[model samples]
Target: MVHTQEYESLLPTKNTKHSHRRRSFIIIILVTIAILLGTTLGLAYGFIYWKSRCIKTHKHVQLKHVLPGSFGIEFKLHTKNTSDTSTENDITIKWEHEPKDIRYRQKTEEMVSNDSVLTTVTIVNNNATVSYELGNETCWLNPDNSSIFEWYSILPLIMESVRSNHREDGCRERMWTTTYNGRRVFICIIDQRISYIRYDNRVAQSQEWMVPSQSSIKLPSDATKCGMMDSEMTSLLVVDDDKRQNTSDSTRQQLSYSQTYRKDNEYLKQPEIFVRSAKPDCLFIHGIGVKSPKTGYKSLKSMSYWGHIEKNTPQCSSHKFIQFNTVDNGWDSVSLHKMFCEFATGSNVDGRISNKIIFTHSMGNNIVAAALHRKVCSFDVQSSKWFSVSAPWRGSKVVLKLEDLCSGHLGPSHHKSENLLWLVLEHTKYCTHEGKMSPAYRTLHPTYKSPTGISYDDLVAVARLHVTGALCGTSPWGMGLSLSFSGTLKFIQSFSHLDQPNDGVVALNSCNVFGKKFQSIAKFALMSVNHLESSMKFGCRKPLCSWYQIL
Candidate 1:
């Protein structure tokens, strides 16, 4: 190794003329070699420093406890190198990483390889190649890019349409805010040259590497946001996150969630959601099946939807389940809205809007979605926390499936399936309009971009805006209990594996309020339970004490 010496030679000044002459030829050669060496070393060091600051990333790192999934949905945030064509960063998401239910019927036809590719994208500038596994059949999200890998969803479009709305107006159309362990620590919609905070990992200013996860995380996949022809599905997460940040802006203030103290003496330990100082004023909205109940939740306790909750907390209790005058009839959005508004608007502090927590199950969520969107909103959306149980955000293609299955689509072989057919048929009949879907059902049906402007996504947004906070939670009975409604669901999922994971009643994604807006929303901890199980506690037949956990 040739080390450059900075010290001065003391004897050099006194060196003889003859000695200096002889050494001059050798000195000239050494000087020439040293110059070439120094130049080579300087260029190599500069390249290393630039790459470290711009493209450095750490993999599989731990993150702070936030939600419950404790895992992250990975997103590539590096600037594409147009000059380099390296395949070192190519990633293939495996189908097997997701565990399949044992009770799931084997679809022998759509045999998925353990290594089957899921993400669809086109690569031009040697950007990392990422693949995903979103069930059977190749998903076509952005017909132009060919896959999920190439195209970004709604936020990018909203950013494009309304560039003046954002603070980062200087950013380009493809700009992405640097996301961290499910949090946006720093948002620079410019390039990799900006600094970011990826949770515990401290990085140089230029790295755009992603952080890890905790809970409440979501990804941009067409499976969850599938066939989004409707404005609702396309814009489920389009609400600006900044509005949630402003404190003084008074039209609609967002709720901030913090851990709370639960009362042990309470009769029921309801699933935790939202951030609140005191117990909420509880309102239980039952499902379509319970619309014609013989009596209210008091009579059908623990049996009907919303029946899991107690009538009243022991004096000075946490919440009160609001009782409304009921008549036996199928659900109609207009009537339900007026009735709900009257009961909810009763003279409480601030008229009708203070410390309210609304709980809806199955079809009940459909109505709540409508009520939140209506112009004459009576129910308090600002000071309330909304819980949606088993809501179908995207419309389910259940026309033939519901009718055919009741008519022996399973061939009467399974006696267990035969018994529940009548019950299923009776419940489904109420949702049909024009021999198919009622107006509310149409909102939940797969209309995909109709001109009528009925959108479940807009429903999601309205709740986010008006309510202090909201969450959509339920157990997807992917594999149902043998002699129950889940058995019917298991049968449907058996044949329709490509529909993606669902709770037999609603697809998992439909009930989940996650994505850019919700900020990597975590998976429900109650994954072990099914749709019907929501009425009862997790792992017991008693009243529901637990449903949606942080996990």
Candidate 2:
């Protein structure tokens, strides 16, 4: 009985020892797993933080290294009157930035006007500062109305002038209203270029008017005066009543001539080499489908026809016309950039230096967008106006679909026997898939690389106009149909993925820049026009003529 008791006790101790060892092994495994998980999470977080720091540092370096050229100024007129009936025209503001010359001194008194209401001013002179004075407040303005300024329409022009003429020592200012000795007083002063603002007697009491940077202004419209008339010389001056009356009479004479020519049915004239204008220079860039004549290949003659029409128009007749030839096989943004940069730097065919206004169609729009984003063109020295028609700002689903079809060999087996069909399909694949590295696709893709280093706000420095075609009919028979059945089918198939109101070739939504949408100078939607007809139709010609007249 003593031996049996001892054996039972010894069995319990042995089993207990094994149990303790098993528990210790499990505890070690759990601790090891916890440490590994903690290490993985820490490494991931550290990598992300490092990447963010590099990006921030790169942006800081870019901004710090910006070369000074032209300076811009923003003027805000504040009234203490809290009344809701204040008119923006109640305060007359005038300013000028001019190089010291005889003509400038002579026009000084005429330029300083108290009768005009101007809220925003831009100083383009690299060497001179802008000067402004406010006129006596009128009864039409309520001192308490805080939103009486009409700065919305003219702010883009001011920002453009400043950006185009950026200078390190450029005078920048923000103005506001405050109470001085219980009376409403207006203040005009320069914004100090610093990290923070200190409100002293020199600044208005309201700190809200202080802008962080001169380039940070939010423009309400894209109608900029970058390459327009000289604001400093012409905008500030009020023309004499007699001179205005004479100008009105002359304008009527010109209108009468245009009306007579239209009534006589002599609108379409034979193509001729028209004399180039001395003032504004205009350049026309065709889309991807339009091959350059220089390539000695099948080219679209549509731009040439449009050129003839523009030359006949009264407004565009005097403006110089510049035609650019893009690559015939595939549209490339880098190639377009090189051509535009060369043209901007070189004198025109007429051997004259002038400002430019670019008109682009389809893929040409993407080319210009990429070039501007890359900052390849010297916009500060050669300002420009951009008009984009049927721009594929977003990548077209048609290209993606085509890529899949080519990759999958989904076409009819007989297509391999048809040489023409095979040739067309191969060319399409080459342009769309093989040319994926091209800047054109790079700009349109969702994962587009940002080359500008600057934000989309910087693009507002150039005036932009967008024109889209909508309300196209689903007509089965047209010139475009006879040329390529597969192409026509592709165009029809594109509508399935597109938003309503799309041109046969491009969707309206695809034409607009996503995320940072800049307000267009004008947006025109053409009704009852297909893709080909949009470029070839008669009604489409009229709006462009009108735009030229306004310019």
User: What's the CA error at residue 519 for candidate 1, in Å?
Assistant: 7.2
Q: Candidate 1 residues 366-427, lDDT tens each?
A: 56565556643545545565656665556566432443443333222332223233333333
Estimated TM-score per prediction? 0.40, 0.35
lDDT of 1: 0.36
Model 1, which residues run further than 4 Å from truth? 1-278, 293-303, 311-332, 347-352, 378-382, 406-417, 423-443, 448-453, 466-483, 495-498, 516-526, 537-551
Cα lDDT tens digits, model 2, 362-386, are 6666655555555565443234345
Q: Candidate 1 at residue 424, lDDT?
A: 36
Each prediction's RMSD to truth: 21.6, 29.2
CA lDDT of 35 in candidate 1? 96
Number of clashes recorded per candidate: 23, 12
